[model samples]
Target: MSFYLDHAATTPLRPSVVDLLTQSLLTQGNASSVHSFGQKARQVVEQAREDIAAAVHADRNEVIFTSGGTESDNLAIQGLFSSRNPIGGVARPIIVSAATEHHAVLEPIEWLAAKKNAQVHWLKTGSDGRINLEELEELLSSKAEEVALISLMWVNNETGVVQDIPAVAELASRFNVPVHSDAVAALGHIKVDFATSGLAAMSITGHKLGGPVGQGALLVSRKTKLDPIFHGGGHERGMRPGTLDPAGSSALALAVKSAVAELDQSIQLWTDLNLRLVQGVITAVPEVKVVAVDLELGTARVPNIVNFIFPGCAGDSLLFLLDAKGVAVSNGSACTAGVTSASHVLLAMGYSQHDSSACVRISLGHTSTQQDIDAFLAHLPEAHERAKSAGFTV
Candidate 1:
């Protein structure tokens, strides 16, 4: 039997989302149009927005639909930067973020720093993968006037380490700096209440929450100001300009609703599964290192994801071996065109390049079961042995 443990990459879509998407697709009209047909579509889109907002404890008007997490991230970063540092206005050049952020957030910030001359303070994390808040306060205290925005992820994509976004937002509030969080990983897995989060903006995607892959949104606070990244008709408050997809939006809303409704049950199941998986790995391979194991699960870290480093084994080799055994898993790092590299997140957390390259990520979701976990554990010992023989390779 094929066992899929890489749910953090993208969870399987729920049947409800599929049914809603299919039904909505059959109905026609652009959400931006004013005709009767368009009005119907608009109603669907707005209702979806309301459902999603209610799920996240956000205002209905605060949700701005986007293509996905990457686009949402780019919009939040670039839009906020442009608005804060206007053409002929006072310069707020500093961008506060962490080195362990997903490429979606890191790339845009780096682009701004490289092309727009924005200064970036890459916050350091301990070996536990949690950002040093005291260090952030020191930076904000010194350069609060010059900082445009602070972008940090609510949960790390690789290690599932949860950050205190509210604390970060509260800190930024004192200095009047807008804070944006890439909450794509954290949205459905944890209790995410946007109203209580104190964030100026947050990004979330559908695929990670068992919705359509192309659908995602950026929840912008009413008080936050952001210049448009794409110029066109005033869609999504002029921040994201394009005809909105009612079908995708509805599917996303259903996914969000369903995930939230079952959050408690899912968390408990994942917590148990995570414990079993980690324990199995440790028992089978004594050299296995579980990342963020010391953190308090469901608070300091998420329970759905567990990253493991098999000393003397290349992550890619282990990944291939597991796949060969009909167990699907993912590396903790990015894979580009068949080339595997060390995870930046692990590197930022003080892991050596070798250890970073040797880690694999096994993430769970709603569809995951104890049988799937057992299958993975049953096959991992052999995979580990073979991978350890293969050694580390770029």
Candidate 2:
């Protein structure tokens, strides 16, 4: 049997959500139109927004729907950057984030720095993938005026390492600097509270939580200022402009609600499976090095993911070998960035280039089962051994 463990990329959709999506697709109306049909469609979209907002403990007005996580990240980063005021006649263009963030957050910040004249303050992470909270404190204390916004991920997508987002938000707030978190990996894995998080914006996507692709929302605080990235009909309170999608909205809401409702059971199941997988791998391959294995509970890495390194193996080779054995995994954030190079996250955490290149990520989700994990471990030993024999590729 084929074992699929790449849930971080996207998850299997729920049949109920699929049904709602199909029903919404059959409904005839443009959400922006003023006609009766349009009004009906608008109701569906509004209901969805309300449901999703309730799921995340945010006000419905703060939810700005976008195409997906990447778009949400783009809108948050570029929008906030363009809207920041000048400090001493120079634009507040410094964007701060950790190198362990996913490409969705990293690329946009890098783009702003490379082409938009924004300066990026890269926060260094420890070997366990934990960011230096004191460094963030110092940065905000000294450079508050020059900093535009601080973007960070709620969870490291590859390693499942959870960041101290609340701490980050609190520090940035003290400096009057806005904070944006890409909570794509944290929504169902952890209970996310946007209203209480003190964030300027929080990005979330549908596909990550069993909703369809091309559906996401950016939770923008009412007090935050951001320019529109997509200009047109002035949708989403002038934050994101486009024709609102009732089907996607409704489907996303259902998926999120379902995931949230089942969170307790899901977490228990994932934790067991992850511990089994991690312990089994360690026992089977004594050389395996687990990332963030000591992350404390209640505020540590999510259990759905396990990142590890096979000292002398190429991550890509092991990935392909596992695929050949009908078990699938990723090197790290495969969909967001090319896996040809060593992981920037590992490098940022001070892992050697060789170990970084040999790292792989296995992520689980709602549909994962013990049998699927058994299938994974069945091939992991041989894959690791063969990959190590093949040696590293640059």
Candidate 3:
């Protein structure tokens, strides 16, 4: 059997979610229609909203459906930045985010800076893949009034490093700056409650949590002010204006609800698998270095992700060899997989370009099993040997 280790990139839809999607596809009703069919469709959409909200501990009205994570991030960042009415006439609004954020967050911030004259403050993270809270406080304390929003990811996509949401929220609260976390990697693997996080908004995608692709939600607090990116029929409380996909929403909600129900068991399974993988790899390849290995267990990360670097070995060559052995892993984020450039996240963590390019990421999920972990371990040595023979020595 093929071993799929790249769960961070995406996950296969759960069987129940697939069934729900298939069934909902047969229903005929536009969510905005005034007839009985429309009402039924609206009910399904509302029920999905409620399910998603409950899974994330958010109010049903706070969840706005979107195409996926990228769109959600864009809407959250741009919507907030654009809606900022200058308090006391500030020239340019400042946006703060960590240097290790995903491209979905970084690219939008860059655009806002270059085009909209929004100032960008990139927070420096430590070697363990966490933002320096003291530095963040210093920055936030300096000109909090000029800031529009602070966007950070709940978990690092490549390294599985978890951030202290409460700490960041508290910091933002001190200055009354809104915080938006991209929780795509944290949703199913950890307990994420919007009510307690004190974040103004968050981004979550369905495919990352065993739901269907092409669906996601932005959880916006009722008090958070945002300008709608699209203006039309006023769907989603005039925040996002496209015809709602009830089928996709229903599948997403079902998957999220089910995943949340099994969160504890799933986390334990990931912990077991992570330990097995880490121990086995270290034994097989003694020179390999596991990033963030010294971090306290269950404190700095989700149990599903482990990243490592093999000195001098080309990550792409190792990835191909592993693929030939029916083991699917990744050199970096799937979004930037084919690109030959080094990882920006690792660079932000102070790794040299050579080390960053030599790194690989393995992420697990609910479907992972011990057998799959064993299969990966069995294939890794040969893959490393082949890569070494190909002049990619560590």
Best by lDDT: 1
- Indicate whether candidate 1 or candidate 2 has the larger lDDT: 1
- TM-scores of the models, in the order given: 0.99, 0.97, 0.97
lDDT of 2: 0.89
Task: Identify the runs in model 3 with alpha carbons over 4 angstroms from their true place.
Answer: 86-92, 333-337, 391-394
Indicate the residue-level lDDT of 172 in model 2: 89
Q: In candidate 2, which residue ranges exceed 4 Å CA deviation?
A: 86-89, 333-339
Q: What is the lDDT of residue 299 in candidate 3?
A: 67
Model 1 Cα lDDT, one tens digit per residue, 1-394? 7999999999999998999999999778887788999999999999999999999999999999998899999999999999999898549998999989999999999999999989998998899988888999999889899999999999998999999999999989998999999999998899999999999999999999899998999999999998888999899888888888999999999998999999999999999998898888899998888998999999999999999998888898999999998999999798789788999999999999999999999999989999999999999988998998888766
lDDT of each: 0.92, 0.89, 0.88
What is the C-alpha lDDT profile of model 3 across 203-261, one tens digit per residue? 99999889988899999999998888778878897899999888989999998998899
TM-score of 2: 0.97
User: 148, model 2: CA deviation in Å?
Assistant: 0.6
Pitting candidate 1 against candidate 3, the one with the higher lDDT is 1
Could you give the candidate ranking by lDDT, starting with the highest?
Answer: 1, 2, 3
